[model samples]
Target: MKGNAELLARTDMIVAAGGGERDVAVDAAILTNKPKSANPEAFLNERLMSDLRPTLFLAQLSNLLAGNISIVHGVTGSSRTFMGEEAAGVDAVRVALARIEAGQSELALVGGSHNGEREDLLLLYDAGGHMLHAPFQPVWERRSGMVLGSLGAFLVLEARGHAEARNAKPLARLARVLSERSARPPGAVSAALTRMWQTLTPHGARAGMAVISGATGAQPATNEERAWLKSLAEVPVRATGSRVGHGLEPQFSMNIALATLALGREKLFPPADSSGVEREYEGPLERVAVTAVGHWRGEGMALVEAVT
Candidate 1:
């Protein structure tokens, strides 16, 4: 469905960004004058050449948002920009769904964008104690940290015969997109989310299963992903950072596009957490399991369904 000559010679673009916003008053005047600079490293390179802004290092250059999305959505064939923040949006949709399932590209434009009202990204997540100044809970009833949200998530991944040869109508079915990186140690992010949830549900979690948690309520990785989501008994979990508030690298492609719009509206949207780990599902919402647990490192999982 990428017209404009397949978005200029076959669309492909992966981007999960960072290194793009800072200059909160030139980082608060170089942390209030770089330790009373008597020559503190040449006054921090003369306040980084007169207090920044030679286009602010070419606008912070994290591939300049894939070079401005290949110049305003002309999606120039092959492009990537994954920086390690929320595992660069889970390996930019697991390398654009593994380069369209190994044929090596057949339309893609993964996702990412965040600007959570940056005061230098809330002073780099409040210097790792990880923001969230309390009182506005609901990321599994928080009590830990994180609460940054400003988003722009994309998806448009194609190649079910290139989206049925362009007639296109796939709102879901990115069957699997797993990833891991755990040196976390104490039950390491719930054993790397139980080995990527038994390698994305190996005959488990059925019956209209639901989950759309990019659970960034921080701390011990959201309490080890709420203890591996209490083994999914009665599934129904939803923590799009408790209603859109943790956009770290576009929060796992914005919770896999909010679990493909709640499996294309078959349901599953209430329960903004009265702490039952999100419940109140009125049932029948086909398969959707999108979890990314990167409060301080990456661990991903995906398994959206219902494209039928």
Candidate 2:
């Protein structure tokens, strides 16, 4: 059986143990223990390579094949370190996609994990020597501490004809995936907005739906991102992310979850209730978006459809 089924079974067992209250929400759980290491960095590195890497690999494969995957993850200061000249995570995804297009592999699994420990009041640094630093906002004061999280994400793509012949289930028909970076004039938020508007409008026309996830706290960039999304008035827009908080890992997972839910359940989960701002948006606000300003610890944040 798949890990998700096993997890559900385990949850069922727990619920049965507690007399199976139908109305009870399952609290998230984690299992952890200490391992020996000469230093904190060494310990995190070992865990990343051994435990987290393989887990993410499996999760990615499952995501591509069965569309059922679990993200067992943690994060820490050390795991954020840059390794040599290579970028990680999404950059890795870009490279893997290129390789697959070049016939390197039929499918690719891509993901990352991070962990941290306190070292003389400094967080553990990965072998790449990067350290964790918090966003400059005062709201994050409580988040400045050691953390451990893992992320597992993957996608399955088949040669168009192959997928058609096999009658395989497709989670989303990926029309296009593109990346852009803009180094605008120092104060040109307007230009940034214009560029985003142009890029998204055409895509919205093609897809007929767009999901926007914005960041939390004092990051006005989140607002800017949402505005750009709103400017794409050609289609219905669903926003998410103000609820679950913001970080790349959680955003990635939450976006996938939203997409999966859209493709499967035909519904969107509600955004988290972090900001006092009431949910506002016209039309079907059934998609979500997320942003992260700086460091995050504890349970991450995500925003989804208010009505599940």
Candidate 3:
């Protein structure tokens, strides 16, 4: 009865939820009705500790989301949680796919959720110079960087045999998913993407496939991914952040879900900008290569292909 039984439900299963930031409790000091002291920073730690219930601290257990889902939805399956900004979500999918392909799992649910509006999260990101300021710009064009976005996404993955047993019609096939982490020197990201692209290209010609990039409007990383994309054969490329903003942990799942839809419909969505990096595709859509480049770490790619 996992709350998401509508998508995936079983007495035995594995569920993974990837998250960049797990909770919004860091801003508890500002939420208090009490007046701010001249030096609130002096007693910030004490005040926050006193305000929170004994059972709950400012550091929220990222797994509570899975717990809640189990409680509400009745999914009594084994669960795992990972936290590492953008890479977490990508790994979640990678693990689920591995399990299925290895005959370790028949069906599973995996994804992530994000709340971009939290003041505390915003403050932290702003401190890092990651927040995009006013005067809107697409992810590629934004000089100030990523605009946070709230998003929740999940995917139901089933093995071919399991799917055939249930007579379920899959919209698309996950041909391959690969994830890697880079030490992140200036050119490291581009090199990583090129290596990943090579792995995804053997499935078919580079010209027939489109790319759905999880390029958050963030710096160095976005530009690096852009450069890597330029080195590839010219194909229709879409920067999802331009339309959905940046959803961090859930970005990989969100982009994969959207790419699946595009593959199912056999069409590409409208491009978000006129950067010439993304252009129109005239052929029937057959596959999409989804890319996820983290703001600070993690690089991943998924090859989604049409089954029929």
Candidate 4:
């Protein structure tokens, strides 16, 4: 909220976004009663007004977050919201960066958030075979099991001159953002990442550069991403979901932010597993590849370079 009122208004285009697991608590409260009827949609419409407290769809719809930010922040320039969970977060930053590169927006704000601690969401993910049932484990350590996380994140972007004029130093430079939805049919996700790596790998990816991954420990996708990462060999990788739990919508933005933090710190965070998958490098931390693999249907990567 402070960001909406303060930082967002200072920008030329505000791209505040995020939607996965945003309103599960409200949804869980409303859809509590199971209909005995075969037609769930019919049951919802028929008993909608009578059973629920005057139709609380406003509380459940995801766009309310964006609208609220506008009303509170006075960011009246242009607004857009993207939905579809992890991919939504990826697209938000992608669009913002595109607009900036096009010179359409000099000052911009972009990021995402997720409130993941809800029974309904956990059940939904579990039903889809995406939730972790066992004790907490590092993302790469467990083949299955995604512990949901509650988180919010945002970033302020400005053109080089805009920042220099204001004397605001940047933490890191976002070289490029590449996001895509994969029609994943075995091996497709890995193939997509490999292709993007070919495009995004600036000079040649070095052991000094690292990967900040958004693998949510969900089945084949997670396993697939791990295999692709291992193929890079010697490039240290950190699975963000392992430490933050899985904040579906905000996961990508959070990873990018963490990557910038590491770039500034000039060191990678310690590995989260003993599985020997995450290795260390003595080389200086320079570039970071931020990855986001959707639980169901998206794969993306972002390149962040150290300012030096």
What lDDT does candidate 1 reach at residue 154?
A: 88
Q: Rank the candidates by lDDT, best first.
A: 1, 4, 3, 2
What does candidate 2 score on TM?
Answer: 0.45
Residue lDDT tens for model 4, 71-109: 876764567777888888888888888888898887776
For model 3, give the 10-residue run with minimal summed lDDT. 11-20
For residues 1-308, what per-residue lDDT tens digits would candidate 3 score against the true structure?
13456444453333334333433464544546335566666566566666556455422577877766667766665677777888888888898899889988777778878888877688888899888889888877766488888888888788887788778788789888999986898898899988888888866487568999999877798888888878765788999889878888888988999999998888999887777677777777888999999887899999998887
Candidate 1 per-residue C-alpha lDDT over 1-308 given as tens digits, one digit per residue, 9 for 90 to 100: 33476456578888888877767777677878888988778888888888788776786889888888788767788888888888889888998889789989888888878888978678778998988896888877777998888888888888898778757788888989898896788888898888888888887857898878888888989988898888886888888877779988878887888788888988878878886777788989998888888888888888889887
Q: List candidate 4 segments past 4 Å from native.
A: 1-56
Off by over 4 Å in 3: 1-50, 53-59
Native-structure RMSD, model 1: 13.6
lDDT per residue (tens digit) for residues 86-197 in model 2: 1222333344445556765433333332211213213222332333245432222222221222222344433344445656555544332223333323324334445434
Off by over 4 Å in 1: 1-8, 12-56, 61-63, 68-106, 113-119, 123-130, 133-138, 143-156, 163-206, 214-235, 238-245, 252-254, 257-274, 278-286, 289-303, 306-308
> lDDT per prediction?
0.83, 0.33, 0.78, 0.79
Model 2 misplacement above 4 A = 1-88, 98-105, 114-151, 164-167, 182-197, 203-208, 214-220, 230-241, 273-308
Which 10 consecutive residues of model 1 have the lowest summed lDDT? Answer: 1-10
